[model samples]
Target: MKGSYSLLDIDSSTGDVYLAKGASIGICLGAVKVPRVNPDTRNVTYAGTMSGCSNCFSSDGTGTLYNLSATAVSTKIRPTSVLGSLDVATGEPRDSVAVRRGPSAGMVVDGKNRFAVAAFTAPEGTSYIGSGTAFVPDNNATGQMVIIDLTTGDVVRTMSGFRVGGHGGSLVHGGLMNSVQLDPSTRTGWTYGPYHEQIHQFSY
Candidate 1:
């Protein structure tokens, strides 16, 4: 495997960082797809992302990141259906062309196994620009959150017109859909993005 793998394998008996370079440069966190092999037919299978970072955000009085630079965010990826065949002879991510480029932040999954990715849409701002300093906003005041559909290999949606650090209280960067939560009892979903500390509530 010439390319690098981001996931790591941990030993139960030992507290060690077994995998090398599991973290993406410039604060990459969120979801990823892992490949597995079945011994019986030598078939390949996929597992969802294990763990990742959440673009840290400052919370309002309610612990929600709303239209703020410090808003927490992340990316998520999961298989909707088997896009690749189980045949190990030819199944090594061959049927997919989904390559994400940006600072990955948070991820969330729904009942249908669909994944929502949240991140700062500044590939040139965070990852490529500095070591760990402040993110030099993309065009200074223009930012957005890109949502990709892993099942269809396309970007399904995007929440644009988000301002980074415009709220005058700490660098209000990007919305890190990191605090998405669903209440099964009420069948309600809550998604908080970057802004002046407001929670966007939705229902099913």
Candidate 2:
């Protein structure tokens, strides 16, 4: 509420709001946790921070929070996944740590399947530093989707499609600007195609 924020998510299970500090185009600063009910009348607290700028934040039906992070790299930057929870009552550090890592950005939580689906649309190679904010992807590379286990933070599968710009094309195309849709019942998900006019879908 006091500082600048670029992205935010309400924990579906807890009602707590998370604000990610960032900009239209820049490196990651950090994040804050605002509890639904302020125990002891506290305003807010820093739940977590990382070296890589967080790309997205999502919470599952069960209140499990997830985020995609990109660290600056000379070669292609491999994104990370932060999975955990913040205490709903007082916003205690149940520890929303960076559990696992993958490629690209965009994500959705399938609580029923206990999985997080991410968009691996980063160009064949892109840096996470300046690119993290500008989100300028290679534009020539195809897009990909990744399925990660919520409990173990393990990437279970990956699906790909051509001409998808999520690799960073536009910060909005894949990172904070776009999204991934999931149908847990059918184990299906969707992503963006920055190079063309098409919505890519994947089944796993």
Model 1, span 19-79: residue lDDT tens:
2123332334343344443444655444322223222221121111111112123322111
Q: Model 2 has how many clashing residue pairs?
A: 10
lDDT values, one for every candidate:
0.33, 0.54
**What is the clash count for each candidate, in the order shown?**
19, 10
Point to the candidate with the largest TM-score: 2
TM-scores for every predicted model? 0.36, 0.64
Please write out the lDDT profile of model 2 over residues 115-171, one tens digit for every residue: 877665443343355342224455554566667787776768766553444443345
Report residue 24 deviation for candidate 2 (angstroms).
Answer: 6.1
- Report lDDT (Cα) of residue 92, candidate 2: 46
* True lDDT of residue 154, candidate 1: 61
Q: After superposition, how far is residue 140 of candidate 2 from its true place, in Å?
A: 7.6
- Estimate the overall C-alpha local distance difference test score of candidate 1: 0.33
Indicate which candidate wins on lDDT: 2
Mark the regions of model 2 whose C-alpha exceeds 4 Å error after superposition. 13-17, 22-24, 29-52, 73-103, 122-141, 166-174, 194-196
